[model samples]
Target: MQQLLAPIYSFLQCETPDSWIEEAKKPEQLKGLLIDHCNCELKAAQTAMFLVRKYAIDKQSGQLLLDWAKPYENFVYIKNRDIGVFLSKGSKKNELSGELVARKDFAHSDDLIQKMVRLIKEEFHHFEQVLEIMHSRGIEYQNVRAGRYAKGMMKQVRTHEPATLIDKLIVGAFIEARSCERFAKLAPYLDDELKKFYISLLRSEARHYQDYLKLAQAISVTDIGDRVAHFAAVEAQLICSTDQDFKFHSGAPVLNVTA
Candidate 1:
């Protein structure tokens, strides 16, 4: 776990607050934590799909990507909230195999498509895994309003073509890195099954952040160091500051409730 967290610790400017961990470790908060986590995994997959559809793939291939995500989308959006049905539908991996037509202007469009697609797949699987855990524990999934963390970083995105893309990727790196870090931080306090699952996610989440950073650096003509630092600061503030709501990625707990 130290080996997995070494890079993430070095990447972020601050750690998740002790207050937040104390609040999250409560018995009552476990369901909310898991629900928020399930939502986060879905959001991550959706974001990857958005990046690919917008910048990398052609219209046809973009539609295919949308089609690939339909069931999960249905579960979230259409209120087809049956966990068993959703799980039984399973992943549509075979349907996703085809020649994705890359956009003409983007030089590394293929790279973007390949990496984002793989990321989407992994995130969706993680989503299902979380749902299975929730189902087994009889915790129902519900949509929760997003906290300030992601929006705080996204507000800093540059509004140009590749610049926007590059900045978004950097933001992606921070989100993934933080998630990895929090998973490690919270693992020791969780039950054996959840501890193992959170530990299992460390490798892929670490690799996902690295993949985002590499793609951002490769795509940007200018040095991304300043931008990365800027977003890291923003992300750190979001993690360390006081927050009212308690969600997976929320800042320090402000509520007085105890276990």
Candidate 2:
């Protein structure tokens, strides 16, 4: 675990605040923490699915991606939060037809498709795992609003074609890296089962960050170091600053009150 976190610790500008950990270790915060975590997993899968559909696949294939996500989407949007129903629907295999070709100018579209599709699959599986945990604990799943962490970074995304794509990829890398870092930071404060689960997530999350960085570099026409550093700064500030809400990815807690 130390070996896995070493690079992520050096990559980020700050560690999660001790105050936040203190707040998170309380009993009242467990439900909110797990709820946001479950939502986060689905959102991660949805983000990866969107990238693959928009940049890599054809119209029909895009529809298939939507079909693949429909069950989870229904659970989130329609408030159908039953764990049994959600699991029973199951996930579809993410197979693509030969007709699903890359755009004319983007050279690494195929790579993006391959990597992002795999990411989507794993994220969905994580979503199910979190749901199972919640069910076992008798904690009902609820839709929680997103925190500032991702939106703040996304506000910096460039607006043009490949630049837009590249910026989003870089943002993806930061998000994944931050997730891995926080998982490591918070694991020791949690119960044994939850601690093990969070630690188990580190390997795949690390790989996801590396995959995003590699894709961003491969697709960029110029050096991405400056852009990466810029987003890293934005991510760091979001982590270190005071945040009103105490979420899984939120900053230092402003209030001592539990959720």
Candidate 3:
């Protein structure tokens, strides 16, 4: 596990505060945590799809990306949807109608599409996995308002051409890296099933961060170190600062009532 976390540890400015972990591992927190986690997985996939649609692919290809998320979105958006029905459906909508064609205008468009597509697929599967776990635990799925963690970083994105794209990628990297680090930190405190599941997540989560970073670098003409460091500080402040909301990526809890 240390091998997997070494880079993640070095990448972030600070580890998730022990206070956050203390709140996260509680029996009562498990339901909220898993629910928020399932939401995070879906959001991550949506973010990847957004990046592919906006910065990398043609409109047709972008619609292909949107089509892939429709079933999952329908599941979430429909009022009074059954969790069992979604699980039993078994992700038929996950398969894309066809391969994406990158825009000739961009140099790294194909790489972005390729990497983000793979990420979207994995995140969708992770969403289902969490849903299955929630079902098994008798924890019903419910919509939770998003925490400030991602919005905190996203608010800092630059308002320029490539810089905007690059900054978004860096933000994506921090989010993924933090998720990986948090999973490692919290795994030992969880039950064997969840512990194994979180531990199993480390590899892809780590790769997802690296993939974001690599795409950022590939797309940039100059060094991304400064931009990365800027977000590292921002991300750390978000992690280290006291946050009232308890979520999968929330900071220290002020008052924890099942998040």
Candidate 4:
């Protein structure tokens, strides 16, 4: 467990609990955690689509990606009763094939498509896993409005090509890295099933951060390390500061009068 968690701990600037195993096995705290995670998976798919549209593909493919995300997004962001049952199927049931249509003027485009597609597939799978866990406990899924976390980071993206692209990718890296870090941190505080679930995500989430970094490097002609650091500061502020909403990526909870 220590070896599996080393990267997550290092990234988050924290240590894993020696007692996490016991906390995770608890039956309480299961529903809220899994539901939040299900919402997170859908959001991950949306983030990947944003990348594909803004940087990778032409307009038509971009729209297609958006359309693919629509149903899942509706499941999470809009009211839908079957969401829990729909997602409760299984993530380990099938392998996703990576074949994509060829394109014109497609230098570096296919790579982005491949990466985004794979990410979407994984996010969907994770969404299903979370749903399945919820079903096992008879918890219904509900749509929760997103907090300001990701938008706060995205607002820092530059408004120009390549620069905009680079910043977005760097932002993507931070989001993935933070998600990996938070998963590890929250795992120990969660019940047994959720602890294992979050821990299971660590490796893939770490790799997702590295993948975003590699893509950023591949696309940028300028050194992006400084830009990455700048966004990291912004992202950290967003994560560590106070927030009124209590979604998955929200900061410290603030009471919402609407709630």
lDDT of 2 by residue, 164-238 (tens): 999999999988988998888889889999999999999999999999999999988899999988988998899
Give the true-structure RMSD of model 3.
2.3
Residue 178 local lDDT, model 4 = 73
Candidate 1 residue-wise lDDT, 1-259, digit = tens: 7987899999999999999889888899999999999999999999999999998878999888888888788888765478877778756632575678999888999899889988998998999999999999998889988788887888999998889999999999999999999999999999999999999999999999999999999998889999999998899899999988888889998866689
Quote the lDDT for 68 in model 1: 83
Off by over 4 Å in 2: 89-101, 256-259
After superposition, candidate 3 runs with Cα above 4 Å error? 255-259
> Of models 2 and 3, which has the larger lDDT?
3
- lDDT (CA) per prediction: 0.90, 0.86, 0.92, 0.68
Q: TM-score each candidate.
A: 0.96, 0.93, 0.97, 0.78
How do the residues 9-65 of candidate 3 rate in per-residue lDDT, one tens digit apiece?
999999999999998988998999999999999999999999999888899888888
lDDT, candidate 1, at 42: 93
Rank the models by TM-score, top first. Answer: 3, 1, 2, 4
Give stretches of model 1 more than 4 Å off. Answer: 93-97, 257-259
